[model samples]
Structure formats: structure tokens, C-alpha cells
Target: MRELKPWLDLIFKRPGRLVVGGFLILATLLSGIALLAVSGWFITETALVGLLLAAGVAATINLYVPGGAIRFFAVSRTVFRYLERVYNHDTVLRLLTDIRVALFRRLSQASRIRRGELSGAQWLSRLTSDVDALDTLYLRLIAPAALAGLVTLAVVVLAAVLFDVGTALLVGLLLVIALLIATVGVYLRTWRLSARQSDRQEDLRTAVIEHIEGFPELTAAGRTGKHAAWLMRQAHQVTSEQAKADTRVGWHLAGSHLLVNLSAVVALWAGFALFQAGTVSGPVLVLLPIALLGLAEVYAMLPDAFGKLGATLASASRLNRDCREDKQPGTPKAAGLPPETALLAENISVKHSGYAPLFTRFNLEIESGERVGILGHSGSGKSSLADVLAGLLRHAHGSLARTDCVYLTQKTVLFEDTLRANLLLGSPEASDTELWGILEQMELAERFATEPDQLDTWLGSAGSRLSGGEARRVALARVLLNPAPLVILDEPFTGLDAETRGRVSKRMETLLEGKTVISLAHGSEALPGTDRVIYLSG
Candidate 1:
């Protein structure tokens, strides 16, 4: 419950809107109850008058006022119901937007320590499914519970005023008991089952995603059928649990309905006895039973709302844990390097969790506009060094400083978007002419010239449509667009042919002449015009 405070505050940030929406929902429910009660009384009274006239007794009854009141209630119910839905939905959507933005910001700022504990699948779940679960918390749980409470109160008050204090107390007590049996009883019984269902659902999602992404590997190994069978088994488990939960909810809801119906009967018996004693009017006696029936709407929503409580609370707890700021006490903040310095490190040591230190007491320095190449064999901490310098990995003990740097790793990452959009990631405001100029420098202009869309052409996921060398060149083009003073390239020429590698190296020399560069590769010759070369040992 405490974990849900932030979300509650956000939902009610605009108190005026929340208040208006709540009022509309209350009005809608009250009007519905009034419409049923008034219509029942009107019909009963009109029939009694007809009987009197037939019996040769003079009687006067005005149908106009009752008819108009019924009409007003019917129309008001419809109008307010629509307004409530619209306003509440709009508010929930706005809250979702704010929640997503906050979650993304927290993820972006997550320390390296926190990131090490999260896998790609877990992050995706938090961003998509977990956020979606919270989205329903407001609409399904909060709003329904609140509206039902207000309606119950209104029903009790109407009973007391038109009848007696004893009648109001009786109705109120019965409603409270019914709500408890419907909500808290159902929640207690289904809590564990709901948690299991949610966990199984996430497991199924992860399994399916992995199966699809690793299809080629599974096929090559002749194990595709095996993986598919495993996924099917998980699906069956999810379905079984869901069916059980639904069965439990159905039985509980039926019980709740029976209790509400019994309450209506009790009201009817009380009304009839009062009328026989000449203590209540005939029309008012009919209204009592009808008003009690109107309470059915309020209790109907309780089973589903409280049944989902476990899953919603679990989601809230997960988000609260993952998105919290976890800075260690007494740790100094890392600051940006001075403008004149490309990079500086003194006795820096870095190690991954539960692993030996990759490098110990390492030292390096580079002035602005220096072109340095790092030569190291496989498993010689080349990539680790690059990550440390680029601030992707934090060091345990070090005095390290560097100006902002852009890193281009061995992998070429491209989204399913236009070439223009991919390039814009490096420089959001870059012009078409500037993009074309960079592409020409990478020798990719000739390839796009054959395409109708050119820079506007869509690149498949991860640049899958482009050849290996072409994709590398496009990645390089994006890196060139970055305005960072320093650039770090880690095995950037890994898969290119000799000729293409030479061509790219020469072009890089020209484009990166005025910027500080750190090229990590097997040999210094892989990077042309290198002013200095450093070697690393495992």
C-alpha cells in the first residue's frame, strides 16, 4: 500500500478534475437508483387511482410531476454516465503518460550497479507489461471502489429519510457485511492464485520472445520442436491457473448476489408490515424494495476488483523497487572532464561483480585533438577499457576524468525506421545536406543513390537489409555526426573485407583528423594516421 502512494498522488495531482469526475460518477449512480424507485412508485400509485375510480370512489392524483421526475432521472443518468467515463479515462491516460516518462528517466539514471542486476527481458517487462498493469489500478480498483462506497451511503440515507432510522441502520449494516464478504473474502482466497497467474504470464512472454529471437539457432540444432513444446506447456499452465481463478470469482459473486437479494427481501417484508400497520403509504412501500434492488449495481463490480488486487500490488512493488534511486552513501559524484583534457586516468581499477579485476592501477592520458590507437589481443580487456573510458562502466578506485565521448562498438545497431531518423539519433537537428555529406565521406552515397527514398529509406531491424560492410559504414556515418570532442571505436572493422577495411580506415583518418580518437583493435595498422599506439596484456 505504501508503494502505491506516488501513483495515487499523481492521479489526484489536479484535485479539481478528480473532484468533478467523482461527483459525476456519484450523480450517475444516484440518478439510476432514483429512476428505478420513482418509476416503481409512480406506476403503483397510478394503478391504485384507476382502481378507486372503477369502485365509484372519487380520488385525485397528479401523474405529471412523477412522470417528469422519472424522465429527468433517466436523462441525467445517461448524460452523467457518459461524462464520467470520458473524464476519468482522460485523467487515467494522462497519468499513464506521466508514469512512463518518470520510469524512463529513472531507468536512464540507474547506476551501473543497478543495471548489472537487470536483464534485457526484465527491463522490457518493466517498461511495457508492468507499466500496463499499473495503468488499470486507477480505473479498475480505485474508481469502482470509491463510486460503490458513495452509492452505498446515498442508498442508506434515502432509506432512513423516507422510512425510519432503524431501516437506514439495517441497510447500512447489511451493505457493509456484503462488501466485506465480496471484496476482502474474495481477495484472501484468490491472492496466491492471482500472483501465480501473473508470474506465469510473464514467464510465457519471455519464453515466446526467446523462441522467436533464437529461431535460427533452434532450427540449426534440430531442436525447434522441443522449444515449441516447452512453450506450449507453459501456455497450458497459464490457462489452467486462469480457469481456476475465474471459477473462484464466479462462485463468490453468486454468493454476493444471493446476499443482496436477501437484503431486498428483508426490506420488502419490513415495508409490507409498516404499510399494514398504517405507518407508511402504499407508494412509498413500493419504492423501498425498488431502491434496495438498485444496490445490485454497486456490489457487482467488487469481485473482479478485489480479485486482481494481488497482481496490481505486486506490480506496484516491483516498479517502486526498480525505479528508486540507490546511490551509495559517502560516494563522490563523477564530474565531467575539463574542456582542455581529452581524458585522464591515474591508478584506476575496474572489476565486474563476482569477478577478478579486469585492470588494476591502469594509467592513461590523452590531450585534446590526439589520435591514439589501442592494440590488444583477444581477452586483453580492450573492450572493457573502452567502456571504462566512455563512462559506461564505473571504476571502484580511480581518479578518472574525460570530456563527453561517443562510442561505436563492434555491433551495428539500427532500428526499423527511416535512414533520416537513424542519423538524427546522433544529431537530432542535422540537416539533409549534412547527412548526405557524412554519407558521402563513408562511401555510402553510391548505395543510396539507387534507392528511391535515399535518406528517407527505411532500414530493417538492426540494419538487416544492408550488407555487412554497408551497415558498418552507415554506423560510422552516424558516429561522425556526433559533436562529442572524443570518439571511441571498439573493433569497428571486425567483419569488413580487407579492401573495405582499408577504405574505411582512410576515410576515418580524414573525417577524424581534428578530433581526439581512441581506436581499440587487434593492431594499430587497423586505424590509419595513429599518432600513438598502446598495448594491453591479459
Candidate 2:
């Protein structure tokens, strides 16, 4: 319950809509009850043809009464439903976006202060599964179920007041008690299971991503079967956990149904007794049972909604804790010093937390308008060094400061969108002409031109549709588009052929003529045009 406060606040942020949505829900529930009341009249007055006809006429009230009030209620409910969906999805996405920005910002600050935290998988989990779990909030589980429960109570109270207040109160009390017992039971059973299930699912997703990303290495080592088996084991584990959690959900549903039915039966017996005592007529007695039965169906859905809301609350709690505990260091404010020209590392060093030293007392400086090649033996901290320069890794042994730098990783990342979409990212205002020139400069105009839709061609899933070299070119194009004063390339020429590599090197040199360029390379001669070479040894 404590965990849900912040998330609840977001949903209720717009008090006007919150109130409007509340009223709309009330109308929807009342309409449903009204519709049921008409059905009851038809059922109880079957022998009276005229009365049945009158009930049918009253049923049309949904269509004609209250000056399109019925239609207004229906439309308002739908509009609120749509608004709820849009607002919730957008809010969850925004929270995730903020989290990603915060995580990266923390990583950047850690690098500045020489602290490297949060693995790629951990960060990825936060972005994907963690954010996904919060979906329960907006998916109507919280609001709709809560509204259903409240509306059910109100209907029972109204029925009691209209009929015999005592019997009505009895039915209402039974419903509330039964609902409370079932909900509490479900919460106890589902809380840990749901939370663990979410965690396992995240683990499964992380494993799948890692296995797929490392496919090449696994294949090279002739361990395809091993990797496949490992992945299968993770998948099975996740499935087993999910199945257990799903079984609990089944139990919750079944239990809720049992309580709902039991309460309806109790209400029926009470109404029959009232009819015998002459406190209620046979028709009213019969009508009470029908309404009670209808309310039971609404009751059954309550516990599951509560359980789902519990899970969502748990997820929100995790996100909140992460946000508060993992404080990101502050960057320079907008009014701070002007962007610097050169990137400087004064005796910089980094050590992994609970791991051996990755680097110690290393010093390097990249001046403005210089293309520096970084050459190092494998495990000689080459990638880590690139990470440092790129503002991805934080080291503690010395100071590293940068101005106007964009880092490109060894592994290329592209969205499942168009070439232009991936290049422009969130920059919607970027002109097509400016974008095409970048692609052309990266020697990728032919690839886009040959495609069926040109820039509109979907580069499916992390740019899987693009070849290794093509993806790199697209990534480089993104870097070029940054227009930053410094660019750090981490093994950017990895899978490219000789000719393409030569052309890329020349093009990069020309494009970044006045910018500081840091290229980490396995072979120093790869970038012959580089002004300086720093060969590092582990």
C-alpha cells in the first residue's frame, strides 16, 4: 500500500479528470445495475405481459433517457477509458525514459568521479521488465477493480434501503466480509510469488539477450549446444516460476468465485425467508436474488484486480527505491562554464568494485582537432579505456574531464525503425536533406537507395536487418549527427572489409577535421591518418 502512493498520485495528478473519470465509472456501474434491474422486472413479471412490456420500455432508457444521458455516460466512460490508457502508457514510458536518462547520467557521473556501477543486464532489466511491470497500474486493474468493489458495495446498500433494510445490510455485510477474506488470502499467496515471478522473467529476458548477443563467440568456440542448453535451462526455470505464480492466480480466482457464490446463496436464503415472513413479496424476493447473483460476478473479479495491483505496487516500489538510493552525480548546469575543446585525463585510473584493478594511474590527453589512435593488447584495458573516454565508465584513481564528446560502442545499437528514424532518434525537426547528406557521407546512400522504401525501410530489431558494416555506418552516422566537438570510436572498423575500412577512415578524418577524435584500435596502422598513437599495456 505504501509502495502505491507515488503511482496513485500520478494517476490522480489531473484532479479534474480524476473526478470526471470517477463520475463516469459511477455512471457505467449504475447503468449496468439499471440494465440488470430491468432484466429482473422482465424475469419476475413474466406472467404479466403488460408489465414485461413496460420493463422493456424502461430498458430503452439506456438509449433515450436523460437527454442522451445514457449515450453521454457510455461515451464518457469510453473517452475516460481511452484517456486512461493514453495517460497511463505515456506516464509509464516517461518514467522509464527518465530512469534510463538517470541511469546513464549516474554512469556518466561515476565515470567522472571514477566509479563504475550497474552492469548492462541490470540496466537493461530496469529499462525493459521493471518498466513493464508497472503496466498493471494503467491496464485498469487498479482503477477499474477498485471502482467495481466500491460500486458493488453501493448497490448492495441501495438494495437494502429499498427492500428490507436488515436483509439488504446482511447481503452487503456478507459481500464485504467475503470479499475482504478472499482478497487478503490472495494477497498473502500472490505477493511473494508475483514479485519473484517478475524477477525471474527479467532474468530470463536478460539471459536470452546475452545468449543472442554472444552467439558469435559461442559458435567460434564450438559450444553452440552448450549455449543452447544453458538458454533452455533459463527458459525452463522462468516457465516453472511463471507456472507456479499462474497456479496461484488460478487459486485466487477460484477462491473469489466460491466466496461470491456462497454470498449469493446466503442472500437468496435470506430473501426466501423474508418472503415466507411476508416482509417481502415473491416478486421482490426473486428480484433480490437476481441482483445479488449479478453482484457476485463483479465480486469474483475483485481479488484478482487487487492481486495485480499489488504486483504493480511492488514494481513501483522497486523503481522508487532505485531512484532514491542510486543518486546520480550532478553535471554542470546550463549556466556553467562553456563547453571545453579538449578531453583531458590526468593520471586517471579505475578499479572494479569487488574485482581486480582494470586500470591504475593511466594518463592521457586528447587535444582539439587531433585524431588519436588507442592501441592496446587484449585485456590491456582497451575497451575500458574507450569506455572512460566515451564517458561510459567511471574511474577513481585520477581525474578525467571532457567537453563536447560522443562515444560509439563496439556493439552497434539501432532501433526497430527506419534508417532515418534510428539516425534522428527523437529529433523530429531534423530535415531530410541534412540527414541524407550524413548517410551519403558515411557511404550508405547506396544501401538506402537500393532498399524498397529507401529511408523508410524498417531496420528490424537492433538493426538485425543491416549487415555488420552497414549497421556500423548507421551508428557512425548517428555520431556524425551529434555535431559534438569530440567523437570516441571503440573498434568502429571491426567487421568491415579492407576497402570499406579505408574509405571509412578517410571519410571520418575529413568529416572530423577540426574535432578531437579518439579511435581505439587493435591494429595501430588501421587509421594511418591519425595524428598520434598511444599504445597501452595491461
Which parts of model 2 have CA positions greater than 4 angstroms off?
Answer: 1-10, 14-25, 46-132, 138-140, 200-282, 307-326, 330-341, 365-367, 425-430, 450-452, 496-500
Give the winner by TM-score: 1
**Ten contiguous residues minimizing lDDT sum, candidate 1:** 325-334
**Candidate 1 structure quality by residue, lDDT tens digits, 25-68:** 78888898899999999999999999999999999899799999
Residue 77's lDDT in candidate 1: 98
Across 100-195, the per-residue lDDT of candidate 2 in tens digits comes to 565455444444323324446756776566666654453345555667678767767766765667766777776776666456766777788777
Predicted structure 2: lDDT? 0.67
Residue 285 deviation, candidate 2, in Å? Answer: 3.6
Task: Candidate 1: list runs displaced more than 4 Å.
Answer: 111-119, 219-222, 322-339
State the lDDT at 126 in candidate 2.
65
lDDT of each: 0.82, 0.67
